[model samples]
Target chain A: MFEKYFVFSPYFWLVLFFFIPLAIIFKISISVSEWGMPPYQDIFLFDNGFKINTTFENYVYIFSDYYYIGSFVNSLILALISTFFCLLIGFPLAFYIATSNIRLRNILLVLVVIPFWSSFLLRVYAWKIILQNNGILNVILLNLGITSEPLQLLYNQYAVIMGIVYTYLPLMILPLYGYLNKFDLNLIEASKDLGLNRFKTFFKVILPLSVPGIVAGSLLVFIPVVGEFIIPEMLGGSDRLYYGKILWEEFFVNRNWPGASALAFSGIIILVLPIVIFQILYSRWSQKNEI
Target chain B: MKSSLIKSTVIFLGLFFLYFPILVLIFYSFNENKRVMVWKGFSLRWYNELFNNEQIIEAFIISIKIAALSATFATILGVMIGYSLVRIRKIPFKSFYIFLSSTPLVLPELILGLSMLLFFISLNNVIGFPSSRGQLTIFISHVTFCIAFVAIIIQARLTDFNKNIEEAAMDLGYNYTKVLYKITLPIILPSIIAGWLLAFTISLDDLVVASFTTGPGANTLPIVVFSKVRLGLSPEVNALSAILMFALIIIGLFYFYFNKKFKH
Candidate 1:
């Protein structure tokens, strides 16, 4: 009976709050829109004598537009670049930390993740201060005689990528470190004994073993970065637009509720649902193997 | 020795990259000038101003209230979900249960926030209970998303937990509720606290979801802070950042402490 309670309570809450909300997004996406208080027509119109009032116009509109498609592509490219940078920086750091002595490993791991625990908006804002015209970076560059004048760094695609890479680096490193820490260090020596050079050993032995970590870390960084709003909003310029910004403007600025809902629902279908299903199946498969 | 030097340099550079902006933010928080980049003599003017700013103070209070409440609620529901997943064998639609609980972890906050805002609006249209979105709506959204995080933590902890202790308690004549209260809950208490802290931090730091779900008078610290720093920098926000970063790092330490203590 108590088991029933444990099972049912969360089941009920998740269904009501989580599942229902997602269902509503789909519902609103299919509904017709107009200028009004709630900004969309009722899907079920009772007063109109059992009329099923719905339209795929929103979906059609979004798919037909270059604006929507381009922004999505831009977001994907942005996410891909940021994820790559995160891996580039995070892999070495994670490798070293995982290979270190246990005591130092713990301290170093904590240090890597400490900034992650700090406020994200502030971290992005920190980039703003650094990339300013007369900021420390320019000051240092001038002192080093690298540039004759302060280069315009703030509010561009590069800054956005830098911010994303910086903020999301720990997410990449944590999982990589998790996998690498569990990795047997003797494998490297064995590979060396087998006459494999460092590069060959890494590619053949280390890299193959850490693929799971790479996938996990990449997913963690890629998925969120795709829809990241704050970094771009704080640091990006008009040089590029992203799906997140487009969605924000659709709902809040343009007042196109159905269009925004369509975009969001499409994101769910395209980006999230497959991954969620994959994760579920993956966990189940792993558990079965564990037994 | 050469490889070790390369490794040390990589690690040093990595840590330096990670921390440089943070240290800069802190360094500038003390700047006496109103212009954040321009360094005058060091002063605490912004810190003093931050305390007196009623909007920020109010938003901070609201954020704390929502985060605390959501953390508590999410913890309870999350523990139940975690326990159910790990221990119970008869959950209806177990895959669906897992999907519901875990999807929020991966779902972008933008989509999640849109769904929630639309959900609340639809709910109000149908039920007329929550006539307007405010603390209640934000609380609900926070708890909804936060449950996944807490559930993940608790699930991992309970999965690693030895079942023999609970089985032993059951065999020794303790009832199900008694065994759980006396044994399982106590053993998993650290994880629960850690879950709560993690949930709290996620909630407090969240800007996107809060922006979507927030109504009048429900502005959170992140919302207010985002507004101030969105277009440009604020010296007062710099000071706030310094203080908030310090406080949150302490919380992070506590989280690490609780989690580490649980490993034994």
Candidate 2:
């Protein structure tokens, strides 16, 4: 009887707040837009008796417009590049940390992830200080005579990618470390003993084994980066658009409630629904292994 | 020799890349110059100004209040979800339930924030109780998402917990509630604390969600900071970053300590 409370309490909260909110997003996405307060017509109407009003036009609008689709494409490309760079930088670090003696592993792992504790806005702000024309990086480059003039580096896609890689590195590293730490270090030794060189051993043995970690880490970084707003907003200039920025503008700047809802619901279908399914299945697998 | 040197160098470089920007942020915080990038004689100049700034101080207090309240709510609800998932066998639509609890973990904050804002508006249209968006709206949104984070931690901790203790307690004739309070609760207390701390940090650090849900007089520290530095930079923010980062990093350490302690 008491266990029912434990189950139902969170269930009720999630349903009312989480599940219903998502349904509401779907509801508004399909609702007809109008020029009034709340901006979208209610699904049910009683003007004459009863009527249902909803449209797929928001979907059509978002799909047909290149601006919306292009921003989404930009976001996908950005997420891919960011995830790749994160894997490149994070792999060796995670592998090395996982290989560290047990005593040092925890400390190194904690140190690497501690940055996540601080304000994300501030961490991105730190980059602004570094990339400014008069900032330390430029100062050093100028003093070294690397460039005759201070290079403009503050806002652009490159800066956006750099910021994403820097911030999301830990998300990549943590999962990789989790996966890497579980495998036997002796596997490497065994591969070497079989007359395999370092490259072959790594590719044949280590790489194949760490795919779960790589996928987990990449998804962890990739999914969020696809809808990332802050990094691009602060570090990125007006060179490109992203899904996050567009969704933000549609509602806040452009005041298109139904349109924004459509974008969000579409985002759920496009970027989120698949990942959520995979995560559910993955968690089940992990729990079974845990038991 | 070459291998060991290479290993140490890569590790060193990785740490440097991670810590350098933070060090620079802190290093510049103490500069007396109004220009943030230019280094000058060291002083507590920005820190003093930060303390004097009414807007930031108020925002800090508000952020703390919301974080604390929402964290408490999230912890309670999270503990329940964690316990239910691990112990209860008869949950209907178990996969759907699991999906609900975990989707927030990966869903983009931008979409989450928009969904939440839309929900609030529709709720107000039908109910009209909230009247307008403010701390309450932010609090609800915070608790909703924070629950997922707390649930995950609590779930991981509970799964690793020794089931024998609960069994022994049940064998000794204690009721379910008594066993939970006396044994399970005590055992998982550290993780509950850890969950709370993680939730607290998340609420505090959130910028995107808070921005979406925020309204008049509800500007969180992140929202305020973003408004100031979104297009350009703010020197006061540099100082605030140093202070806030130090404070939050300590909280992070505590979270790690408590969460990690139970893995033993």
Candidate 3:
């Protein structure tokens, strides 16, 4: 009897709050736009003989516009580049930390994730301060004689990427460390004893084993970076646009609710839905194996 | 010796990259200059201004209120979901249940915010409840996303512990509910607190979802801080960053303490 209460209470809350909201986005996406209070015509009409009012024009408009498509592609490219850099920097750190003495390993792991505990927006803002023309970075560069004049480091794609890789690096590192920590050091020795050099051993033994960590960390960084709003807003320039900004502008600036809904719904379908389905299928497969 | 040198360098550079911006923020929070980038001399002027500022204080209070309330609610519901997923076998449409709970973990905040704002508007249109968005709306949305975080934490904790204790309690004289209240809840209490802290921080730190759901007089700390620093930097904000970072890091350490305490 109490079991039903446990199952049903949360189940009801999720359906009401979580699931319905998503369904609402889809509904609004399919509805026709209008210049009105709500900004979109109701999908169901009762005034005239029972009629359903819906249009796919919003989806068509979004896909047809280079402005929207270009920004999305820009975001994807940004996510890819950031994920690559994160992996580049994060892999070695996770590997070394995993290989450290047990006490040192715990300390390093905590140290790695500490910066992440700080406010994300503040952390991004920290980059803004650093990338300022007279910022510490410029001061160092000039004093070191790397450049005579201070470089314009703030408000560009590179600055955006830098902020992202900084903020999201911890996400990548934690997962990579989780997988790498489980790895056997003996495997590396075995490969070495078999006459495999460093590169060969990394590719043959280490890299293959750490694939799950790579995938998890990459996805963790990549997906959020695609939809990231603040880092770009604070650090980015007009040189590039991203999906998050476009979606924000579509609703708030253009006052195009349907357009924004369509964009968001498209994001859900293209980016989120496939991964969720795969996760569901994968978990089921694993559970079956366990049984 | 050579490989160890290489390892130390890699770790040093990696940590430096992670911490450089943070150190810069803290270092500049003490600058006496009105212009944030200019370092005239070290002083505590901005911290003084930050405390005196009403907007920041009010927003901070509102943020704490929402975070605490939402974290509490999310923890309760999350415990239920986590318990259900682990212990219950008769869940109807288990896949759909899992989908509802887990999707928020991966869903981008922008999309989630949009869907929620739209949902509130539609609900008001049909039901005439939540006539306007404000703290209530923000609280609801925070709780929704936060549930997944708390659930994941609780689920892991529940899974790791031995189930034999609960069985033993039941096999003795204790009833099902008695066994849960006595044995299971006590075992996972540390995780429960850890999950609450995680939820609290996530809610407090949120910007996008709060931005979407917030209304007049409901500006969160992030909203206030973002508004201050959007076009340009503010020294008062610099001071706020210093304090907020310290407080949040403490919360994070506490979370780690509670989370790891019962693991062994």
Candidate 4:
């Protein structure tokens, strides 16, 4: 079908289909600064001439509204807490795997990666079963006489954190593994040779040198968690709200295209700022160390 | 000695944390109870129901079709872009190409889904080709994201590749296209296969992009399972999860076996 259209009016097809879309996207971005009103509102009136005025009302509304503000805070807090948990659990495993001469290191690495190969939604579902009120964990606890009643584990903050950490741990490990795998043993040897204890040597040498990997891994986990919807929606109960869920509700449930676009655009800006700063700092630190 | 034991135990516990949920999922697939929590002894009833469900079977077919077609398209486009970046010199904005290709890996799926949604809506209004969103639009979206991964992997492979063989082939009076097909391609076949499998798995696993782009009569398995879980969990959902796990495990075992056999 496309081939027939292309053959019929070659230049027309090329210009209209490809170049025109590119031009429109470029124009939309450029017009944002000049219009003095939000570009997202312009998208609503796309069929009418494509001119837009920038406004701060949408952003103001997001901040002033209780639901939106609460969700935004919830998203940030959840991401931070999850990143900390991942680092706590992941760091030790990565350190052991990196430093060991164990023959099964490769095997263990493959084991760690297998769960990642499973579908994300399936893995989350697996957690739902494990954390449910009458789920396996509660059953085991009750059977062991540790508790007489089943615990409320599913559809809560605890479950969401567990799900996030489970899904993102592999991501944390791979980068740290890369850095630690390539780490020079001689530095540790030199520290120990100077009578520094193992903990001191580790803190003074390994941890400091691996800052780049830590930053990279943290950014990788943090960015996605901020916009996470699936884990929260499935694991988090009715009361829990996050920025991603807000955007989903606006687009699909509320059918508020303008509101959704504004939220999404604002989200991109908020998420990117810290990452941009971190990248800049990381580069500068690396350059100074090189010098 | 105590610290070493603690370290080893920590490692073991971490492994348990990772595998425990999946094991529970597998175990529950055999449970005879309607409630996923209570173990009412072992049976194959859920798997039996799985086989009988027509809607799930159709969804499975749709999922496979999307995966296969999108993977093929992604591989072709990836190889083209990868080859261009590796073999061509003096291309303008090469760094830009690198950034564009890698962006999908880092960008939020919601953002990608929304952008593509907007892009398609406009395309339909303007071009009138994809008159209504459905299988084709969804396939295109999957391919769009999948190409980035394929291109990155193939490009990494190309960087390590020795160029002398290609130069020698061309020296024997073979044209550029001939050298590419006759020599370059054969050498990079393994990477291409790896890239294709990666793309295939990603397309199969996607929910966010598929949810945004998929129209009526084209629900993928992940989307179906998601909506079902939202309403309530069922033994059938467990059965479906088990089936997915079984399929992945088979593929994984085959991969390792082939890898070992080839190594020998």
Best by DockQ: 1
Question: Could you give candidate 4's per-residue lDDT for residues B1-264 as a string of tens digits?
Answer: 997898789789989988888888888999999887788999999999999988888888999999999999878777766776567654445444444455566657786676566667767766776767878878978887887788877777777688998999888998877887888888788778777877888899899888888888899888888888874677998988887977876655544443233222
Instruction: For candidate 1, write residues B50-133 as lDDT tens digits.
Output: 999999999999999999999999999999999998988788999999999999999999999999998888888889968988
Provide the TM-score, chain A, model 1.
0.98
* Candidate 4 local Cα displacement, residue A11, angstroms: 18
Instruction: Sort by TM-score, best first.
Output: 3, 1, 2, 4
Kindly indicate the candidate among 2 and 3 with the higher TM-score.
3
TM-score (all chains, Cα) for each model: 0.99, 0.98, 0.99, 0.86
Per-candidate DockQ values are: 0.90, 0.87, 0.84, 0.40
Per-residue lDDT of model 3, residues B91-166, tens digit only:
9999999999999998999999998999998899889988999999999999999999999998888888898888
Candidate 3: TM-score?
Answer: 0.99
- Residue B84, candidate 3: C-alpha displacement in angstroms: 1.0
Worst 10 residues of 1 chain B by lDDT: B255-264
Better of 3 and 4 by TM-score: 3
Q: What is the C-alpha RMSD of each candidate to the true structure, in Å?
A: 1.0, 1.4, 0.8, 5.6
State how far residue A37 of model 4 sits from its true place (Å).
Answer: 21
- Writing each residue's lDDT as its tens digit, candidate 4 over A35-97 gives 222223343346757655555555666678889889988999999999999988988888777
* Interface RMSD of every predicted model, in angstroms: 0.7, 0.8, 0.8, 5.9
